[model samples]
Target: MAKTYHHPKHDIHEDAGSMRADTKSRTTKFTSRHMAVYQAAAAFAKPPSRAWRLVWSAVLSIVTIASATVAFADALAVPEYVGSARCADCHKDAYETWNKSHHALAWTAPTAGHVLGDFNQSSFTHKGVTTRFFREGEEFIIETDGPDRELTKYPVAGVAGVAPLQQYLLETEPGRLQSFDVVWDVEERRWYHLYPEQELRGGDAFHWTGPYKNWNGRCAECHATGFEKNYSPVNRTYASSQAEIGVGCESCHGPGEAHIAWADPALSYDAEDWRGLSSVGLTMDFGKNTEADIQQCATCHARREPFLDGNPLPGAPFHDSYRLSTLRPGMYHADGQILEEVYVYGSFLQSKMYAEGVGCINCHEAHSADLKADGNGVCTQCHSSAGNPEFPSLRLAEYDSPAHHFHPAGSSGAQCKSCHMIERTYMGIDGRRDHSFRVPRPDLSVSLRTPNACSDCHSDRSPAWAADAVAQWYPDGRHTQFHFAQVLSPARLNPDNARDDLVDLAIYDGLPGIVRASAIDLLSEIGDPEIAERTSALLTDPDPLVRAAAVRLQRGAQGSVAIQNLLPLLDDPSQSVRIAAAREFLNIRAVRLPSSVSQKLDRARNEWQQSLVAKSDFPEAHIVIAGIALATRQFEAAVAAFEEVVTLDPQHIDAWTMIARIHAALGNRETAIRVLDDAIKANPQDISLSLLRTDMLP
Candidate 1:
């Protein structure tokens, strides 16, 4: 029999815990004792091995959640997780098919076959630093700058990724893995550093030995299955662990123990057993071919923040486990085009394809995770003249024909991806295609300063020149009339002037959630007292991302009113909303919460701290910690956190400025001047830093 995704025989719709209005009774039942148990378990479960402590904490959290959850389905009695090796017994075809694929080789122990880079004392130089790769006995070694800026020999601990680029993991300390800044370009067959233009010396955040490169904090969760990022804020240590070291069978399929039991021929099973728990012992229900299937792949593919204790299971709701980043500046262009290394999910969510039910599996294989076809073949599956009848809304067009594309056959200009999905090179070498799948609009590009596919290929032509060419082709202005970038661009630059435009964009439900959320975020810059009520009311928005943005916008409102409006969100079902509410509420110092409300505020505050602690290695996370400390007048703590930020990112002018201010606050004028001088040296090109230093002169 051909394999099929398992679904419950009956259609049963279940709301997420926080979204269900009826679950208020269940939430009310959760007492102080329950909260105490959670705290006690976290406190007392600290075994020497942080790995074991995480396991204990997870088990306790699950138990507490199970007892209190009324919005979730009945718990599936799944057994313990079994390794991927066991799946080969019955699924030989799948096991073998995936064996040699990139997903299977995504991570591997350093060996003769797995190691791609040359190790015959080959040396590569970039930004005034030369790293030598050579073999020492049975181990691969690289002689590079260590944490203290001295030449040191480090053995290759593990290898991450394959094909386009491969990065080697080096063990800087026991149980701490750091990715080498330099990567081996597999196709090019040369070592290239991510930051080739700028010198990333030791102690810099971008350096391989620094915190941003720490595998445990930054990369392990997605690379491994059943991974636990066991970070301790007190000791500033990591005791991370995983069930399997690569993206194994369980990584996408979830645990296999119960699936193994169901496969047994000797076992007496009923209809319910065949239906077999949550999507066949997996956490996600994929049979419906819904958005959840794409979300499973998105868990690793997107730039997002985890909303819970550990990595969420497969098939979980995207918002339930992770809070997706909106089309925020610095990450995306004003017109919602990919501008940074945002992966795919954030961009895909904005496309019409996703809205029309186009999923990852439609273009890619389920097991091997390879594209079903190469290049235009993947798109032509649904976009050909015949078209996919499944989606009748998509008008049939002979996309492969010369009449449609208007370029010579087999030319790069004629390719569908060239016009629809432009590629942006990130990490210096890897070219990631934008998944928004938008039509090339040089017209909008001219007005918004966004990149257009036409200009990408036509190097000599300007956006206006390309726009004129497009006008001759289309003749009609219909295609260029509708664009979110026009309003978004002005709103980003001056929200005060674009008040009506931003408000219109925020309330426009027809637009993508990310775009709407971004508009809401932009409204925070508006100082209009008239818009206060409008922004505050968005706290009740259905989308968690919108609510999150609304909480930030409400920060400028009257303190008592802001606290009252945000108090209810402290107990919101979504972790992102709760944390945002807590953070914003705490910022309003004038409004003191009553004891009844303070209890919930305290728990939410702890969640905010944990979120920052988990990402402690990041300079941005340290900045947040510093901001919180400074807000509460914890000068010493704030100074230390800001100093840590400066240590990680030497050229961080904002952190340097904060550090100088903290010293000045403590009545040390000389120390403040010294800090400014150091910042000026690190960021010589920064006129702001130079000006600030001149102001600090005695």
Candidate 2:
């Protein structure tokens, strides 16, 4: 007879931190339930501290464990930051390197020496509006349009960034720091507007004073140390604070107080003897030998949603603190090249290097965040003709030689990054490189309309020329197995014939969760009953991201089936999964749901609502709230929510579209036409709005 262990029942509740707290507690209890499995795999534990947790989980779950466990290091309570100045005393070499690095200068006070912008009454004109940069009694000032569209003089509060461009922060209200639209290009020694073509006026969301540009809510956390966006949703204000103005030593290494405590000459620093100290006297272990190293840097480098409502610890599990963005249409090109301002993480996750255990520090110095070597020197470190015995997968022969590159030695085309990592310009002047570390495939650029490194520099040549060059060099076809974009692009463009392929891709465990999630999300457009039915199995995918994406795909299924598919996910271990389930489940009418099922749905709905409220400071969050209200038939609430999105960002086209649709649904056809006309007036070039207006005309 087999024994069954019933998981402890958890009473779900409505609270800001209730769900996560409950999950942590429940998972802790789950460890005890696997006592038998724990003893069996005790010897397999590698790192004595972290191994016990994973061995028990892997043995009981009967799944191949991914080295490290997701278990939060419980040895430490909340870390307390000790300022960077305190660290300089013992670690002089690291301190000096960091002091001269980009991270240290990422943010700074507006001192004359620190201010790289020429504030000697310099002026820049954009769209007929002139912004004057001048100095006033030891203060840097910028005369620009205020929130009301009237010209106003505001004192520069701080400077952000250093080399290519430096953005100024202006205090529009007490404690409200808004990034100025006009920035100074240090290299060019000239003032320029970030949005040169668009006439973005005050009251618009993209305006400097708007939520998207607010330094406190949008950009401060990544730039500052121990920052907290103390947002009050009730009053719609921020009392943001930070331990330090710039990224400090503690920012990457976690809080230094515990480390300081253990570092004292009186205390024992031995790893074996420091069991009583918090996490062995370190808030985070940035051991480059461990998997957590890449994650530490990715905490801020990744384009992700901060699920936890505060600043995250340096080395915390990414899933606990952030919901990493997957390869979505607007965020990434169909061929998986970055299209928008998706920071490095999403692109790097798609790379063969990531799968081969390459991390940020492999090519970068941990302290300075600079490349270990210049140009091809970095590539030669691993791909040299001698070859790296450990990384046997590397095709390491004469990579830097002209014969391999088919370009003149020392030419721009011969550089490894020039061929593999294409540069995309963002913020008008800053050119960030794609870190996916992929082989150049100009063929995909032709078929999928995706940018390739080959085409980026070859302005006089075509992709066909580049593809032929690559074909001749390799002889065999470029590796397609690693190129997920080939299958994904077709699925997105023609889901009718590609539905079965997409379903297989979505549930395939061999691929990364991000790839699988992207496939599942694409299936959302397919209203085919067969695809919908087959996609139901993905609701229980081991990965939470896949499960969440599957919930969206099943939204078009029959009401009863959709509800059934989503019900179990309400109790998912991951809050993001539960939230996705709850929102999708509520899309169906509650009147049709069985009494018992409705009760569960209500619980899930409340949880979802609370999660949305937690991120209410964001315009996107309000849009999601509006969508929920519209789906649940709360017409007035939906209208109010949509209106709030416009209030937050006047140029939010989606809000205007939803508002018009609601009015039309409520039989106010004239009002719908008026709304569309207004949106079209604001954005004349928006073809979709123009088409919608023409369709709405009586």
Candidate 3:
């Protein structure tokens, strides 16, 4: 009998979050003279004589130069979306599906119909602290103990979601920024004070008005469309805005204007493939394409940083810009069960399915967020009973019954995922199941003391008993060794003695790239003279990742030999290796180099600067460059970079504080005072800013 596949059905009729009705009230005021100059420059750029072109170019350059001089200057104005009404005209099916999915209703407007929680004067206590949730006319209000036991009334700006915990948003800086308070009770269905013990001790991180209150920098990037945090560190304020309130049609499709023009039937989008286009509508063959695009989505969704923002340039690889979480300590347990806060993407990469080219879209439908097919149906798509002709040894029949599972047919224990994939809850209620999909190995579990599927089910039973049961079921079965399990023990126990073993593991070709990279990281901690020499030779390794690791581990080594070996890797094909080389070289400031090598290093630095120019709105990039400039004693460059950072992201209090220090160092006391005044206006309730101002006054 053929096994039937079961697809999980997901409701796709949910509403996308709330609309920002208050956006029209806030307007950015630019200087009249600057606007006039910009208009004149725009007019001069039109088709004209050679003399006129020269005049236009010069004027535009002047305008560009002047615009950077002024603080809080708005360049690109984001267009507002009317609503989902426009999208429904062309894509009715997709719109309907999105409405049903959780993406639509992730955040919602407060109303009698839409509001889920009990907001009518309710007090809830958690961890020995009390918080009251009440209503101020139509708006929801939360009253919690502020600094010195003072009761503070915070208005709920918006609701996060319906199920789980209904998180409330607080407007810390009115229109400019809003932040989510950390505490919410799922069982009592009420709001509670977060970090109650710390609050009682008078040292709470989430005291009403803190650095975390700048929601635009902390949260808006992931939630809204084209979000620019627009924080001014010098001013200590946020002037953040987005193109859209929630994820809209343009989020995935790129800008819709070009797409709309192409879709018109009158004008052929492509002259060559008109008939082919009519026959087959827009369909992307995800299976045929390389994993680059899929990896781009994974970059943000999987807990990685932005190397470049908006649209990444072609051939710019993922790992070059972002540092992925390795299977390191605190992230995973001894036998690879997730222990700390992992965002799934790292763990998923470890699976055999991912290595076999199975992507996120294979299991998950794009629009609906539902499983493409149910249960065994998804697994059998590639693994058929007829047998995989590519790998004939994968006979499906041997693994299809109670004999293999050692459990009765139709039982919960018989299900494949039940024994293999374990579910872990995060953020109190969000249950995420592991996707690594490894079979239960109780024998290894006993040796390593990692949790096994049998012990997970039979909580009272020991690993020894589980191993004996597995042996009884398959008497001749061999316990396969995990490479990580093998290397981890010696690496942790005797770091000094394990140098050679770690280096060998780092260069091992057959081992997984993640494991190899991890071994390299471990070796960096206790690497001696011999290991450093071995790592120096690896600067010429074919793989960029290994070569990059080699550069990182050999940072502190002196002498001309080490510096000469690393200079050539500055132009490596992989940006990761080049950046690594740059950082390593920058560390050894006094090391003399050949003029040509110095020139190559300068060229690499310019490339990094150019990359930053392309994504000027990214605050993190500015901060990194500013740190680099400060270290090099380029005080002017450092000040400029930090100023740009503050303008791009106002909620950066640390940046503002640093800018004031820089001004004071430069003997510009007036400028420092003005910067503080701006910061105080942005966050008037910030006690730290108040204290800083008092200290600076004298």
> Per-residue lDDT tens digits of candidate 1, residues 580-696?
776675457655558778677766665554455445555666666566665556566667767767876786777898889878878987999898888887777799977877887
Instruction: Write one digit per residue (lDDT tens) for candidate 3, span 624-664.
Output: 55666565665665666666556655656766777888888
Ranking by TM-score: 1, 2, 3
Q: Write the per-residue lDDT of candidate 2 for residues 1-698, one digit (tens) a residue.
A: 00111100100111111114312322233233232223334444443333233312322221122221224334324446888998999999999999988899889999997899988988988887898989999999899988999999999899898978999999998888998888889989988888788887887777788877878877888888888776655456778888888899988777676687677887545544332234546646666344578777877787776654455666565654556677766678877788777788778877888888888888899889999999899888998888777688888688898888889999999999998888989888999899988788888877777788888888789988888888888877573434677788887667667777788888787877788888876777666666778778888877777787777777578877776777888777666787677656555555466766655555455445434444557766665555555444556556666666666766777778878888888989899998888888777777888888788788
Ten contiguous residues with the weakest lDDT in model 3: 10-19
- What lDDT would candidate 3 get against the real structure? 0.55
Cα error of candidate 2 at position 87, Å: 1.7
lDDT of each: 0.71, 0.70, 0.55
TM-score, candidate 2, is 0.81
Using TM-score, give the best candidate's number.
Answer: 1
For all candidates, what are the clash counts? 1, 0, 26
Candidate 3 residue 332 Cα shift, in angstroms, is: 1.6
